[model samples]
Target: MSEKTGQCLCGAVKLTARNVPSTFNICYCDMCKRWAGGRFMGLHVAKDDLNVTGGDSVTEAVTSDWAKRAFCNTCGSSLWYEVTDGPYVGGRSICVGLLDDTSDLTLGTEYYTDRKTRAYDFPEGRKQLTEAEVLALFAPTDAEEGEPE
Candidate 1:
């Protein structure tokens, strides 16, 4: 993996996810839709791998009983997330807009199919999985501590 760095729009918060995330997700969950104003493309970084720096101006909201969403208060840029207790563990699902080369990354999975809007539709045959189905993506995998195996 390469060193990829991203900063909030107002520069009040900076972060580094040292390696490519073990997985990714494109979420259509209502919570995500409400937080993202439509849909959310998230890059998953393990709790240990997400470094929150210059966070003096970062603000967080408890979007749900088990999750917290963080954003840069200075520029209103949704930064990352904290899954208090869920199938995802503690991964920080950083906003895809914060990434530098998001185009190079492959779309992994689109989640929350049950709640997706009927106003829009996924084209072709992209896999769409419900919440329980997508949770399977976070299943334990064989990998070295600091590297993808």
Candidate 2:
């Protein structure tokens, strides 16, 4: 139940999250890569425990039917990725790159290994899951029914 505070680039938006775990996750999906300019590193922050000041400066986009991403409108700094609907509704993963301090964060997991390109590679021995495996872990139960599961 650690507490951390961070702000977007240019300090236009300030955020605090309570009950944060010490681990961070990385996403290597194409959308994430395009969003963050490479793999996206995120710190899981519960929606209920997150507080933001200067919300007026934050703009969000619905990246997918199930998720949306928010960023600082002023500096265009990536803020967070949030579940928009389904079982993960209200959950958020904040951008770790904007953290004011991150001496405590450890690599927890990486998803979209299959999407990883030969142009870049992370260190060996990281716990990783391919795109299909990620879908199995996160796809909402409703989406699984009657779909190509």
Candidate 3:
């Protein structure tokens, strides 16, 4: 694990992630493809391990019941995708493209693999999880389900 720093394209939003993993993951979900204009590749970091500067230029939109996506409002650079509520709450996946040095990083997982378009293809033998698998892995726990009113 190492520290990584980066900024938005226009430099309006900057961030530093501590203890970041050397592996990153990709998401091919429809929303991710539309948001990133392709597969969304990200480095998972704990919320507390990520420090942001120029946060005023950042904006987040809740994209799903459990997750939200952030970007630089000024330059429209996708910043990170965060799990807002669920077992993975407090986890944020920073856009790998936003990192300053990613030479050491490698592909870890490919999510929503079934949704990937035929226009592109990654080399075979990579770890992949389909939408159902992803959903099962992150499904809300009993505690998160809340008691019936």
Candidate 4:
């Protein structure tokens, strides 16, 4: 796909991303829900492919042993979820809602499905991964590479 542009709610932070796909993943983990107020629909992108302006306004908090969360310090709009180590190093999961245009993007997968709260449920048939399944898919691969899981 072509490059896309977007900005935070207050426009204090703007970004341009190249080579973005037409799909995004949804995370139903508790941390995701707490951070984003619901499922976090993130557009997966390579870190280098995403360029930002007003970067000084972006602040990050290490949310886990393997990744950190970034947001606009001015408006608190989520920017992206970054991997600190492992095969996915230099990769980021950009917040889909931050995109200026979202007409082309589709739901790719849902992670932490088993942990999804009872308050919300999605339609059946989408690709789904439970917490255990997600760990099994990523942990060993990164562990073998000597990166923190």
- Top-lDDT structure, candidate number: 3
9-66, model 1: which lDDT tens digit per residue?
8777888887775456888888888787778888887778777788788888998889
Task: Residues 1-149, candidate 4: write the lDDT tens digits.
Answer: 77889998999999999999988999999888888888899998888899999989999999999989999998999989988978888888999889999998899899999988767767679699999998888765667889876
Q: What is the lDDT for 3 in model 1?
A: 52
TM-score winner, 1 or 4: 4
TM-score of each: 0.73, 0.79, 0.80, 0.79
- TM-score of candidate 1 relative to the true fold: 0.73
Residue 104, candidate 3: C-alpha displacement in angstroms: 0.3
Poorest 10 consecutive residues of model 3 by lDDT?
140-149
Query: Cα deviation of 88 in candidate 1 (Å)?
Result: 2.6
Per-prediction CA RMSD (Å): 16.1, 17.5, 18.3, 17.9
Can you write out model 3's per-residue Cα lDDT over 17-98, one digit (the tens) per residue? 9999989999999999989889999999999999999989999999999899999999999999999887888889999999
Model 2: colliding residue pairs: none
Off by over 4 Å in 2: 122-149
Q: Which residue pairs in model 1 clash with each other?
A: none
Q: Please, what is the whole-model Cα lDDT of each candidate in the order they appear? A: 0.79, 0.90, 0.93, 0.89
State the local distance difference test value for candidate 3.
0.93
The window of 10 residues in a row where model 4 has the poorest summed lDDT is 135-144
